[model samples]
Target: MLITRRFFPYFVTQCLGALNDNIYKNVLLLLVTYSQVNELPISVNMFVNLAAGVFILPFFLFSAHAGMVADNVDKAMLIRRLKLIEFIIMSCAAVAILSQSYLVMLLLLFLMGTQSAYFGPVKYSLLPQTLKENELVTGNAWVEMGTFISILVGTLSAGLIVASDNSLVAASATVVTLAAIGYLSSRAIPALPPQGKIEKIRFTPLSGTWRSIAKVRQTPSIWMAILAISWFWFLGATYLTQFPNFAKLHLHADATVVSLLLALFSIGIAVGSWICERVSYGHVELGVIPFGVLGLTVFGVDLIFAIPPAPVDLSTVYSFSTFIAASQHYRVMADLFMVGLSGGLFIVPLYAFIQSRAEKGECAQAIAANNIVNAFFMVTAAVLSIVLLGLLEWSIPQLFLLLAALNTVVALYVYSQVPEFAQRFVSYILSHVMYRVNVTGREHIPAQGAGVIVCNHVSYVDALIIMGSSTRPMRFVMDKSISEIPLLKYLFRHAGVIPICSPKQCEKTYEQAFEHIHQALNNEELVCIFPEGRLSADGDIAEFRPGIERILAADPVSVTPMALKGLWGSYFSHKGGHALTTRPKRFWSRVEVNIGETVNGVELGRHGLHQQVSELFERKS
Candidate 1:
């Protein structure tokens, strides 16, 4: 992708933009923090916050309009225009830095934020337009990695400039050069013509925001995803906003060490983003959300405990090398790094999910909605920081601890609201942790419209494996007994699992299960049924039941036959004995999910479907 014409230039353009933003923003922040300017009308703490809020405020005000513009125009062309604006902003910013004008610098920050607001929609919207479907997650991961890498470099650059003899000259040159290079990169991005036909004579921020949010709310998952991503930004803004103060007051560190701590965090996120791409295996996998949330909460709280006692001398300020030499300091560094690593794991998938799921014409609006919500959260974080630290006098570590606890509540609510995340968590554990699932012919699953997937029942978790393998959601057909199992029942119910039993066992369940299947098919949703009916007790496919034909007869939708091989004898399977009752035979076994071509239900009756599945199962095994 780095060498690809469509991706590389865009990547460079966005990354350079991120770098220039951070460089200019941090230079202003560090000067006010360490320089102890006497001209400030407010307390240093309040001014620091005011500066941060000034930069974020434009995103809230202009994002809706920006999103509207991005959807209605050529995104590549718009990006080039935005970058030119960015260059102009940076050119003026250089003079402000050289003159040491704090007020002018703050105003420039707001202008920089305005450019970023417009750029955000175009930057994210262009990915789906330029890359292949499979490349979405990888693409997001790479961009995230680059963004953080640039952030760390820019942060360190700010520190060195401030420490230099001619601080003004160094700061002036860096932002201007980065901005100029970013503009050049933007020019190389291939044109992405507008995908939507909606005509608007002008951009309306307030109305556009409300309407974009309404459009986003049309899909529950996307709406929740936007909230999740916004929460991430809120949490991120808190930690970043407090970092300089956290370093000075808590660690007794200088400006260089502040940059050092931030560098570690940024590097950790970049590394984690790379790992997330590898973990996803070319799919927009959301299973990692729970995992990311866990690490985020865990490490964020541990950071408080990891902070060592401040040096005996209040005046003892440590240089970068002195700070790292101590063992306890390592814990604080590691904790911050893990927090960032977890964050990287958390955000990439949500970006890809919204991008892939949103309508092509409305993708920019969706991203714009995300930006608006993110701005609101970040500004809230800023206010909360002020109330707690300024009004209440809580330490930075205490603030960090409270935020971690809040993360648990927020993550629980999100998971509870969207059980598919829980379902994916189960899938992630099975496929990535318990077993390595290799899927083939995934393209057989209909990209759109109704489809029925029939697989041989090998284990209790076949539905999960099938769900994980599918790009779309699958409403699985399960046994009545299995559906009633503890813990699994709640999961099954929310996941739209259809539970059926023999007519003699329970006529109502038998009838209702088929009814649900028909209803799901009519909605053009994917439905998966295990034709073998029950888990194979002897590690072989039971004779395929004819019930599949009965369901297909009602809707006659495209029937895709798939096989699950290498699942027999697993802890979940009824291999050698009852399922989950024996010691696990293998910890990281491999399973194969081979999906065959879709066929008409009327043409391929139960036997033909069974034959196709059996051939795929045997051929793969």
Candidate 2:
């Protein structure tokens, strides 16, 4: 339903374009293998790889120009023009297919790549402009879902069509027809105003590429997202490029079986993408990424062991059904599916985050930089595959192991750089999986700038639930004893949550908490303090502590009052007894956080702030 008006046409247009691209690509590869075109004295393997190379080469060469044009002109009109170019290229491809001209086909592939290179930036940048802020993650989900599904259909169609005619006529027809459909769909896309003005257009490939990359690097978060996205592309390219050969050589399966494996992978990604929209509640939840990468690594490694030794008589081909007849073989298929599913979860958030976080007017250019990096990573993956499989004589299974291990390293590095990813994930698990969290007046949370968030402390897990609900990250002030909880110690530290104690208990710790709070406020960061200084023994508001006065005196920041209702009797609360000692009564209980209007720092005193927070929760009660 959300896809009806503007998003649907764009989705169809993008899906058709992806389908045509893959159909043309797989058709060329199929032609090299099955067609008797011996025009040039090159090995079929070399030509197949060459076709792949030509398709991606334009990304490195023209991405900067594409990004600039996307930002400088009307995106809808640009898309229409790009679709027209695709139609013409497909027409030329049809002619090339009829003549069985390898050189001409390769050239047409380059032209198609050129068209896609230009479309790439426009495709991603258009979302933030056309859709509402809330729709971004879901929109990205649909787009990614469509892209992979198209890949599945295209690969299957190419395999079947080429094998049937011993010629690419059907494949050619498919691409050309899809191109026309894409152009028609493009016509329905509403025009969007250019994001930025381009005073002049420059086409210097190397320097322009560097400039674009440099622009993205200015925002560390966006740049890291780009790198993570590129890594996914690298993993995807390695798996996809090897599927046909992997099926034949590793599984002793026929072309149809290869298509079947690809179909499983594609379907897994589509399912995962669709699910991401539901689990994230329409926001770009960085929490989903860690779960995704964890699955990616775990299953990727499992795939190494799932692969059985090759059967005798490697020339024998097996059907899809026959390939799955063995239990071990089915496990391999499952592993591939899980990898794809995780891949979807890993990429959609990063794409959404990039679109949301990139400096205004530079979203297109940032995505273009991402495209450049993605292309490079894919190319590198190809080379790495060759080195490991060809020169090092490592088996494909071993390569899977190496990739899995490398993914773990990358995941750790990324989480270390942006602890928010892991922090958000922990919050996500607590709020979504362990308990259901609902929030009212969530808009009261400031979108930007510094403020002090004051909430009535209800439970040990209150901070985690609130973190999951908030759009922006906040550093909470917690009791020093609670910070000693083994499971949460690392998360609290990484989230920069300040821990304090009473002056009598530890004067030094109490003093240090104030310093941290002051620094956080000065740095334009959101700092949340309980103000009560400890969790309530009874399920009622405790006396507001004087610590709030000290914090306010130190830094006169806006005070936002939030109430955590329904968390009074939760597992991490002292409802039955001390938290962790008492048995839980229920799981997945509904918890509501009601945010009230922000009070000016100078106007709201400690007693007044407590009264305000109490009234906010009392109304909900």
Candidate 3:
């Protein structure tokens, strides 16, 4: 639904660009692989590696400058120019193919890579300019889905064409046509104004790259999200690079089976990317990221064990149908599919968040910085795989288990670095998986600046529900006991939740809660507190505690009253004896959060705030 006039053409342009890049690359790969003419001094393997290196080297060399150029110029015109560059590069590639000149083709590959390098920052940064905040996730989802599907199509088509007698002619014509179409699509993109005055261009890679990275680091949330995204690429490169070996050495499968496994993985990612947007329901729901990481790890570990001992007759290669005939082999493919699916879930939101959160002028630079880090991670994955599988003599399955174990470490590290990610994951699960949550008067919750959200604490997950409903990050001042819940403790701490207790019970915690509240408010953050101090035993509003008064007295900010409806009898509520012991009566009930108008903190006394919250609850009921 968010795919509007500008976005549609932009999306098609990017997809076609990717398709053409891969078509050319894969065609060259096939040429070097099966061509029997001993025309050059280099081995086929070396030539293939050289081609791969040439294509990606530009991202390392030109990304920083590309990012700056995108920031400095009108994006539509820049894209059109890049498309023209792509067309010229492909035309040259076509001539190289016609001449059967491998060296000329390699140079063209580098030129194509340079064109792509310039395209990278513009592609990502353009989304924030062309789409609204709510549309970011959907836009990113479409981009990712298109890229993966294009990869599949391009690779398959290149393979098919390479088998024909006129391989060069077909591949040459295909890339040129795609590039011309990409240029046409670029012409249809709407012009976007320059975000900020572009600074003087710095062509030096080391200095420029460092500047871009520093710009990204200026925003901690953006930095962490980029890291998480890069980690997905790391895991992806590791897994995909090993698939061919795993299929051949472990499953004793032929080329067709290997291609099948890769195709399944690509399809799964596309499905997951689309599913991420659907499940998120127009929100940049980061709550699903951890769930995705869990799926990836669980499936990665499972795949390691799913492979049986290598067959004695290693020479006998099984076709795709024959390989998948066995249930175990099918399970291995399923695991691969899930791994890719989880990767999609893990990456899409992180990308969207960076786009949404980044400062306007530096967005393109930030994306370029992300590209640099992602490239680093991918190269690291490849090197790590080599060390484990070649030098260490570890089997492909063992390498997978090792990588899965390492992924757990990386996920935890990133979550710790940015607790918002963990909080969003929990909120996403609650909002999308456990319940259908609707928030009325979300606009009452300010998009920027500090405020206090006073809400009834009806259930253990009430905080998560409010979090999922509101776009801004909130620091909830919750009961110390609730914050100590083992499953939620880390999530609570990382979310910057202020844990409190009565002065009589814990003078230290009470003092600390006030201190945290002051600090958070001073930093202009939204803080939520349930003045009741505890959950209701019966489905009634508990007496308001004086803590809200204390918080406002210290920092008198606007206070918004909110109520949770339809969660009174949920598993985490006190309708049953103890919340932990209560079984969930309903899994996917509709929960509504009714947010009232922002009342002046000084004007509303404890009784007034209490009355406001009570009215909200009653109205929803």
Candidates in order have lDDT scores of 0.87, 0.86, 0.86
lDDT of 2 by residue, 64-183 (tens): 988988888888999999999999999989988878888888899999999999999999999988886678899999999999999888888777787784455677778889999999
Between prediction 1 and prediction 3, which has the larger TM-score? 1
TM-score of 3: 0.89
Kindly provide the TM-score of model 2 when superposed on the true structure, using C-alpha atoms.
Answer: 0.89
lDDT of 1 at 1: 79
Candidate 1 residue-wise lDDT at 279:
90
Those runs of model 2 whose alpha carbons end farther than 4 Å from true positions after fitting are: 41-43, 164-172, 195-201, 308-316, 325-328, 478-487, 498-524, 543-560, 574-586, 597-612, 619-621
List pairs with backbone clashes in candidate 2. none
lDDT of 1 by residue, 1-621 (tens): 767989999999999998889889989988998999898777777877788789888887788888888988888889889999988998999899988889899999999999999899888988988987779889999999999998888877887888899999989998899888988988888889988787684667677678778889989889889999999888988988788899998999886787787787888888778888989988889998887899899999899999899888888999888999978799999998998999999999989989988887788889989998998898789889989999999989899999999999999998888899889989888998899999998878887788888889988888888889975788988898998889688889999888899999999999999999999989989999988888888877778788988887788888898999889989888877899898987978889999889888668788888888889989834
TM-score of each: 0.93, 0.89, 0.89
Q: Model 3: how far is 186 from its true place, Å?
A: 1.6
